[model samples]
Target: TMAGTGAGYDLSTTTFSPDGRVFQIEYAMKAVDNSGTCLGLVCKDGVLVAVEKFLLSKMLVEKTNKRIFPVSRHAGMASAGLVTDARQIVQRARDEARVHTENFGEKIAPHVLAERTAGFVHLFTLYGSVRPFGS
Candidate 1:
């Protein structure tokens, strides 16, 4: 268990609890798990993304809702975590995809986009000031 707010073990991501658990990392993983599932598939035909809607409201219109988005003509994504954090990743993916097309004259691969997103997310874990993104 977390001993206290100022405990040495609780301060660094490299520190592990008595049970051999990194509390901060586990907490971040749990946050993502609490969100609904996001279905994504890549095949010879195209890329597809689906998200389970949770905050349905009578006054809210479907037209305003924009979860799944097209990164490019052939690629898009739907996320299941913090919307702001997810948007940060989505915007980065869009930038990468655009740069790929501009340089290589081909649409970016889904796996490449996923790898870049993962790499970006990795930073939060290693750095102290930046907290891990739940998305």
Candidate 2:
């Protein structure tokens, strides 16, 4: 059965009623669900990630890959769909980490990076032409 989209909901990031709900975010989430799979593992030694690779052909030359990426010395992330979007988020995270260390004289912790980046992601869903990141 098909799921019902909420009534009177406008599927645009710029529009919202008094209820303050954005159905466009829901739609973006559904789109993200169709992206590739990515897995992350943390053990005693360090962090490891296994990501899905979609190789088009044997002759396609390798450029910069968009799968696993590093945010800071202590933090990294692996993304599936819209890896370009993920790179933007990662760049934001990296900048935040740098500002944190420059101001506090300490490395940004992984949990802290995650928390701040999550808020950044939420802001994109609330306004502008920005859509949700698939990672």
Candidate 3:
């Protein structure tokens, strides 16, 4: 039913198709889904995170690629998608936490930091000049 109708709209995230689908975001989700597996569990002392990444080459060494990145002393991020995009987001999160600490004289709370990071990521969807984040 919805065949060629998605062609023109899929060009930009700011464009919504007839069925109200943002094709760019849908495609980005697909990319993330194929990246790898990441899991987190709440432990007695703190949360534990694990990542399973597929290496593109047999020559590559294990544990050379990083998937979990530290956002702050109390917060971290596990990303599944493009490494560059994940790094960019993580760097932005670090900047946000640093700014919050500098302004408030206290570390940024996890919820507040999440909200700020989400807000920053949402901007890409609102502008035609930017593509949706791969992660």
Candidate 4:
């Protein structure tokens, strides 16, 4: 799971079971300091997630709302912090996966995709702190 803060702040929590089940909950504030909250729940395949807003609106109230975005049919994202940065990262991953599928055909295994994603994230995290703004 990825998380962090921008525009608004979020307090998020998650739980996982030994049987490969997951549960995530988040509380988001409206402004950087407001007191409202929204809730979200997602269950896909064997993964589950839940989010609760604290001070923020449950749904997008502006055209610029970028907190929650769908990455694929089987994947969606919610940001508790650093919403824009996280969304960009997720979007890039989705785009890369799409490009890979277009080039390599759709027969790739889920494990392969997951491994690639892990490698990408690892590389980013490793070099991010040393690089300028982690291009």
The residue ranges of model 2 lying beyond 4 angstroms of the native Cα positions read: 1-11, 14-23, 56-60
**Colliding pairs, model 3:** none
Candidate closest to the true structure, highest lDDT: 3
Per-model TM-score, in order, reads: 0.75, 0.76, 0.88, 0.44
| Local error of candidate 2 at residue 133 (angstroms) | 3.1
- Count of clashing pairs, candidate 1: 0
- On TM-score, the candidate that comes out on top is 3
Candidate 3, residue 12: the lDDT equals 91
lDDT per residue, candidate 4, 1-135, as tens digits? 223321221211233334432212122122212322334544564654444444345575654645556656655555545455456557666776687778987643556656765566455333313211111
- Where is model 1 more than 4 Å wrong at Cα? 1-12, 41-48, 56-65
Model 1 agreement with the true structure over 1-135: per-residue lDDT tens digits: 323642565566767778786667766676678778889777798667778777568887765656687778877778766667788888988999899889999888879888987888898888666677777
lDDT by residue (tens digit), candidate 2, 31-119: 45767678888899987798877775678667566678878777788876676778888899999999999999999887888889899
For candidate 4, the lDDT comes to 0.45
lDDT-better candidate, 1 vs 4:
1
For lDDT, candidate 2 versus 4, the one ahead is 2
Candidate 3 segments whose C-alpha is farther than 4 A from its true place: 1-6, 59-64
Q: Write the per-residue lDDT of candidate 3 for residues 1-135, one digit (tens) a residue.
A: 334656899889889988899988887787788899889998999999988879878997887678899998999999888778888889999999999999999999999999999988889888888888888
Residue 30 local lDDT, model 4? 23
TM-score of 2: 0.76
Query: How should the candidates be ordered by lDDT, best one leading?
Result: 3, 1, 2, 4
State the weakest 10-residue window (summed lDDT) of model 3: 1-10
